[model samples]
Target chain A: MGKILGGDNMKIVMVEPINISMMKIEEYRQQLEAEGHQLIAYSSRAENDQEMIKRVKEADILIIANQPLSAKVINASKDLKMISVAFTGFDHIAMEACRENDILVSNSSGYANQAVAELAFGLVINLMRNIKDSDGAVRVGKTRKNLIGNELFGKNFGIIGFGSIGQKTAKIAAAFGCNILVDDHKQHKLGEELGVEYLPIDKLMQE
Target chain B: MGKILGGDNMKIVMVEPINISMMKIEEYRQQLEAEGHQLIAYSSRAENDQEMIKRVKEADILIIANQPLSAKVINASKDLKMISVAFTGFDHIAMEACRENDILVSNSSGYANQAVAELAFGLVINLMRNIKDSDGAVRVGKTRKNLIGNELFGKNFGIIGFGSIGQKTAKIAAAFGCNILVDDHKQHKLGEELGVEYLPIDKLMQE
Candidate 1:
């Protein structure tokens, strides 16, 4: 079996719960253990920064769900070489501290792209159609007032982020015959491929 | 050319304002008129049921956003044949009355499936990791306290309604390493193909 750092087995500790299904955890754990790594999982709240530091003091790799690791916690852990985050948003963790200590940080990306983009479209339709509000009125035995909603057939859709999620959103928007406008930090060639218009963030936001 | 029964072009009454960038109502109206149908668009609330009824009495097709059409309004329209709803949910309309009157009522169903399902997954992860709650805390300049979230790998995903929307949801859930359990009105072979276990509604709800 493969090993980390020429060791027979690597000891990895989860700093917090990774918001995923139990089966997924078991699967990942099995895969890791098969490769000669020991996985330690905890489902309790860290009592304090000190408690967290103490628990991870012996871990070779630390996997965090959403918990923030302070400079002190990183400094206290002498054996930590890698930090794998389950969530995409990494604004919580002190990256500078991890960098200073030479701890590798990895975050999950492109997993929730389809899910987040789909939800944004659903919310827009829900807001436009008042489906929930009408359902609430009917559920309470109130006289049903038909709330008029507009068709999404030909609307303008402005996407803020042109990441994987944004591209997926644009595809769905196109299927509904929407005119798409995308604003992103990086230059997007999708405008030519998907018939989307690229606009500056400030100008796009204004419209 | 196609012609209305009354010889004059048939009118299409729109109840609410719709964002029409890709497909303009005027374009549709002209196309319909070329085929010998008139289009009359409305964007005002009904002062009273009588006023609303009078406006819609001669309409061949009624286009609504979310305004509720009571049974009274349905009965008042002597020439109404079709009601095209812009949104997905049709709970606001009087389905029984429309059935009795032979007035066809159709709503957008598969349009926002991807969007809504995406949101559900996003919410699941966000709630599990306390991302939004943590972001709110950090925005106020509070010291970060990491919350533990469950890993999504190898979890049981119970899905209701195995239609296009539910199936789409199952596909995304599978990408996250979830074992899907589906509940639907009709037997679906797709569930078996996707390796999703089919269960009764009661059992699904209980789980």
Candidate 2:
């Protein structure tokens, strides 16, 4: 296999990586090693900065998911050329260090947009129907003392920031027979398609 | 108020009824009393046959819900001309004594069909999402360890009875993106309207 950049095998380290991927860490390691790169992965969170520093000291590539990649860890490594985060947000990463070191930063952004939307709708049901409260009651054999619930068959649901996440949430709410109202800086086809009316943010807040 | 037969006010007794009714027992009694029928509503269960006998002694009409109107209670009252059960089922009341004494039995059937159906669907989401278990976890500050849950995006749901309750559950399931299969003695328009498939009892059991 031709080496990347025609140099010695590149060292890759992933810190506190999660199992949300389709492939396991070992399989990813094997695939990267076959392509002439060394892969090191920590399946669990590092206890301290020292532990994180030790793992990424020789890494040419650093991968992280959700766990904070503090400036201390990033400054400890001069060899890192790229920081890969397996999530939509990059706020937890030390972007300043990467910029100073000429390191590239990439994230799997928009990957969980649909998932986020689905959970929002589910949580609404969870809250309205008193699901969690009733469950605790059942466990203690005191079910329904204060377990009265409200239905979501015909309810008003408001959405802000009508992006992918907001659009997905709207679809689920539509299925629930909810009258969805959206307020955003820019309008999209999602509102008309879902039969959700676009209203002024001020108007939405009042009603 | 003039009586129907120029007779004294009718004595009516309700024994240990439940709160599953659409209208509260007191509210129904107030409506009945407004129409000149005497209402004696029990707020608690009758412990023994004598207790039940004492409650319905001079009653011209009897009302019950969930509590057992034993044969002894029925035989004790020769004045009863009607049994006004505040629910759909009549299994708890004594049918034999009513037959012998020529007493008319009536129940408030289909009163709670919508409420029952709405709750049934709410419970499905409650169970699938582990909302209750997670709530218990959060209450004790053990949030989300071994409390992983599944979404109801696409699943197979089987309904044993396609009456109001089952059909209503199917509608909610469809909202949650489920493929519904119903098994009943007779075919129903509910399946067609909801785009659910009706399967034979044996076939449904296998699938």
Candidate 3:
């Protein structure tokens, strides 16, 4: 196992596909083989634990994306040294199995920071302006009588957490001329630079 | 008409209500009356041409929203010296009457610039991310199987008109990490400042 961990010809298996195309995966496989590592990339997720176990049996490092990796399969992967999660969340992965087998795990954090932040705006605008309702109304030749939407400009935008997603959301809100109020556990220099007002959770809720 | 224009106790009649509340209008009326100008703000729009003509019979200045101001109604306002449009668009008003009657016309332009620009984002995000469909899917216990949406983080945003609304829309787009392309009648220095590429209409459409 130690030899496999440090070996140049380690086997890497991707149990599930990421957002990339199969052609790209094949290109990656060839590139990794050229670097003395054997890459076995799966185009789809394993249907069952038995299949997952079989696929990861010879893998020194396994790549997965949102597919559930149970303790049974993880313990059965005798050569598994590390698990590379291609998603931001690793809750589906068997943490206890990794701990018991001393398997290292890495996740692609911050991969959806901007995407999620932008979605925050989308949801907010949908609520404020009644975008869904208005779109439906206009298609039916209805007037914007009761559907007069509210504006986000000159409004107080409250952010509960000051993580990467929160910071990106604050930037977009500021671009729309919103005053940002943050109630994170700790104050950040970046928040201060963005002129965000820091308040307690209670006070932020009132705002 | 010259006397009406230069009169100290000029009567201003608002034929239709703007977005402001009637209480605010009452406040404005009191303020205007204190300055030797009488402001008669109707809580609702004029029901007919007769009501409109009767309303503006004594008005030296007419303030209207989207209520149609026909040439007949405009011709009947003998004392009308100026038309103060409370809306951005004055197309509903009789522009020909204003010209024939030598009445100066003014509109509240640029009032909805930021509001319109923000709405542009709302609509774009709705279309790109399939927000409406995804929202419906989740409400019905469906997953994002075919509703995996696109992101606006790295996209080309085209602005055909580089007016106030277009400039504001460009600012928000730039904040979202989009490459902006413009095809206004003339190149704007602000577009260059924002690193927006000014292309021909056909070229911009390709982007």
Against the true structure, whose lDDT is highest? 3
> Which 10 successive residues of model 1 chain B have the least lDDT summed?
B1-10
Off by over 4 Å in 1: A1-6, A20-37, A141-146, B1-207
In the order shown, the candidates' DockQ scores are 0.06, 0.25, 0.60
Model 2: clashing residue pairs? Answer: none
What is the per-residue lDDT of model 1 for residues B1-207, given as tens digits with 9 covering 90 to 100?
Answer: 111335556778886665453258778878889988888776566777788788788888888867788889888887888888988888889877788778878798887786566556655665555555565577799754565445555778899888877887777676565789888777677777779988897897776
Ordering by TM-score: 3, 2, 1
Report the error of model 2 at residue B152, Å.
Answer: 1.9
Per-residue alpha-carbon lDDT of model 2 for B2-34, expressed as tens digits?
Answer: 112225577877766567453676787787778
Lowest lDDT block of 10, candidate 2 chain B? B1-10
Candidate 3 lands at a TM-score of 0.74
The C-alpha TM-scores of every prediction are 0.50, 0.72, 0.74
For model 3, how does the per-residue alpha-carbon lDDT over A1-207 read when each residue is reduced to its tens digit? 222365698899988888888888889889888889998888778889888889999899999999889999988989889999999889999898898898989899997898898888888888888899998899999988788787899899999889888889888988898999998888888788879999887999898
Give the distance in Å from residue B195's predicted Cα in candidate 3 to where it truly belongs: 2.5
lDDT of 1: 0.74
Alpha carbon deviation, residue A80, candidate 1 (Å): 0.8
Comparing 1 and 2 on TM-score, the stronger one: 2
Instruction: Write the residue-wise lDDT of candidate 2 on A58-159 in tens digits.
Output: 888878888888888889987888888888889999888778777888898687675566566557766776766776678788867766767665788898
